[model samples]
Target: MLVRCSLLLPLLVWLAPAQGALERVDDFALLDQHGEFHQLSRYRHMRALAVMAYSADCPAMAEMAAGFEDLGHTLSDRDIAFLFIDTQGLDRGQLRGLELELPILDDGGRLVSAALEFGQAGEVALLFPERLSLFYQGAAGAGFEQTLDAVLAAEVTNSIADSIRAPLEAGCPLEFPVRETMLAEAPDYAGEVAPRIIENCGMCHRRGGVGPFALDSHLMLLGWSPMIREVLLNKRMPPMQVDPHIGHSRDAQYIAAEDLQVLVNWIDAGAPGPAGEADPLLALAEAPAPGWQLGEPDYIVQAPRQDIPPVGVLDYTYEETELGLGEEKWVRALQYLPGDQSVLHHLMSFVTGEGEDFWGAERRQENSTRRFLDGYAPGQDLLREFQPGTGVRIRPGEKLSMQFHYVTNGQSTSDATRIGLYFYDEPPEREIFTDAVSTRFLLPPNVPEFPLRASRRLERDAVLTGVRARMNFRGKKMKFAYQAPGEPLREIFSVPAYNYGWQPYYRLDEPIAIPAGATLHVIGAFDNSISNPNNPNPDAELRFGVESWEEMFTGYFTYHHAH
Candidate 1:
């Protein structure tokens, strides 16, 4: 059975439809089995988007898939994209076992299924991207083709295609345990829903946080439930989240499938909120502000004051603050205290020589090693303590260069961000440096995924402590992998769905060991197509550059040579 969510249905910026009665469906995105991103809204160029809930284990899957392929071939010339959604959780390799031509959207367990209320395999869904609504959803047969035909019939009217149909019960029943539990008893806001929000989302969605708005109270959740549901279904929130199955990163946390089910199902259940004495989310809101996570600093350096306007686009701000060090300093740990959390999007620091700036060696070469102190991104651990006996060495005459990126929050404010550096009582064992695997290429205009690769062979043994992906608006996803001499390749960290907005330096939960002669690799691609939401201009051919407007594919490898 498929559940319908009609009450308190929030509409997101609906323009009058050009054709057909507007049957509205909110926009969402998902990755196919091939690691390709597919967003429904971006398919406006297509006449129709054909999709079906697929289960490889289902008995009727073969016949239905064959018919779907036939129908796709029939509409080969027409602008129609046919895809399949995996009702059963299938990894890329398992999906490849099916050997299908069409991309199977690998829905992370049951998030998309719960969103569309799909409980059966082989259920069909035809969507009109222009109207942002479903044209048809049912079993794939005569009725399915008829619905699609009437949709593409070029002004021939049929009321059947416009109305929503209850999902047919012919195919195998896909079990959504979470949805079933919710149907039995709605998730209590205070007991289940709000606690999950406080755990996974509170850090970023609170007061003075980087999120667009605060999710402070029960009323707030009610207000933004639709947007929350949309982002959850599309895997947009929990910013800078990497693919959990591929690699492990201390900085990345993909909310558990059960947690996602609770939130989305709660939203589907009208995001009901009843007072239970104290709201957990409100507790997060009323809690003390972000203070020095690593306690007081031995030394503090402040960046220049930044004046942010109420609302508009802002460029990166660069400032250099001389440490004026009387003696050499070894920084074992550090943290950044942003003056205005709402506006200060990100700040990066580097230990450079007298006249150098934030670019360091990035501007001069495709690959180089330098003293990159650290970077600050939203929803990340503020305190960074280096590995035992390792420190970033700063000479007496060195200065700290910082790059500031601020986003306006509809309010005028000023920020004087400060860095707290914790030093070692005695000199550390080894100095830390960041090796970059970067490349320069001319990305073709309007290409969705322009493949790029960069690698460096290690001449000496080293331990990689952290990594950061540096790409501009068009950055899609970058992976950090290594192959030591004859050993098989191992992926340590990956920013699988890289977002330009949240650029966190991923600290590996387990540091990777690289012996001499090991080759490190950075494999990634840029999304210059219209599908990329952050792309400023998909029409322009782009090149590698230092500025944020241009594109750069550099994966920073923070490491220290093994003793």
Candidate 2:
């Protein structure tokens, strides 16, 4: 019986290089349960090998393990190796305790899974050495037995299996042919590109940046050398909306392709030494004071102060205040400065009519606060000036509402928030629009990890676009793509390493061109088990809600409708 194994592989392989059949696993070293090293080339000479990806916590995988063991026993006489790969995000300690009987290899970095196209968690592939073909492929269910039988009996040597496995050798070509471009003289790293990197990528890629690794120094850059080149060439790094032609820079995360090429070329040139002693990056730094990136504000709106207890997970809290904007004012820029920066993880603000308050709503919802006018997170500086023409209008008698989600670092703390606004007396030429994309999905408690996606096609085509997505601590990855009316779908933005504490609105430098009927797709994956360290409750059934405690799938899209 033909089986479907699409859902069985771990989804992380979505970022792997494309390969045809018979692909050789690339160079990657990972540890096994016993802390032994497992290299990709170890199984190269085996006549037939079964690479089974499994997760100990997943019940479906536990059931599949039995079949895999049976198949291993059946294929034992044929000298075929049954190699199990653990794609669960477990460290060495947790993995060793599971006692999986098979020779399991840890693919914690996901390099092997990505190279082999075993994306789902419990998928199996029967590999043949002679022709380097995938003789059988399927999920961890009952139907996998047929594929196992076929592999043992040698009955699946047909063209389909041959086609699937034949291309593995040609799969990721080790060499990237250098291209001859207009600016081919290998751009200077420190001079030409480091400034741009500081401006766009550095804020998060630095020593204390929100990103996992730092890109502040040449040594660090060399450490992640190749991956940096690959992600940029694949348009994956800098993680911004790609529209190189139009749009005013609204966010600090946007990087231009030319800037990317400079870094790529710099890395390609072995990251040569800076041309002159006056370091460009240091020269460019207009470092702000200790507490704020932007100077003190014209107006400071403080939230009612609160003291955080030491040593426990604090429930979501909200504080409300009234900002009496006596008359209409055009805000050209704004900045949010936390009274105590270390404990403030994120803050959100909302504009409300004088009488409509979030305090009442919070009371109704059994909470203490109201909605916020804007949202800000760590690594996010105050809102800066847009192109001369654009500004957010604050009208008289309009109350500015604020909410702060504070995460403590095991320290007793008190926080009083203040926001500064830079106003423009004259109206601007351009306008900004902020719209949200959300989904309705119920998450069952303790059901191993699963995929969740939500999408909405634009009713009418809109041109410039920016997005903000929110998920509880368990979010794994999120992506925003656009399918133009008659063109192929293009991924505009993706957050591969999602952090609950630092959510930033990624803006496209060049506004994306969307046809009137183009559709926008937003997808996100959640890991809601104890294994997912950030999951507040390993056994809580999650459902749709706006509260910070509940799970939510929402995409906030700010766009300008075409005229």
* Local distance difference test, candidate 2: 0.57
lDDT of 2 by residue, 432-505 (tens): 55555556778887643456766666666576456666777766557677787678977776654455655666
Q: Per-prediction TM-score, please?
A: 0.88, 0.52
lDDT of 1 by residue, 1-563 (tens): 12342321112111113232435666667777756667787676577898888888988889889889888888877778899988877777898889998888877656676566566888887777765676667778776776666556655233222344545766798897767778677899888998899888888788878777888999998899878887876678867777666667777767877798788878877787866567777776753566887789999998889999999989889999989999999999999888888888888888999767788778978888889899888777778889889999999989998888899889999999889999999999999989988988999998867899999888899999889998999998898889998899888776768888778777778787899999889999988887677889989997889898788999999999998
Q: lDDT of each model, Cα atoms only?
A: 0.80, 0.57
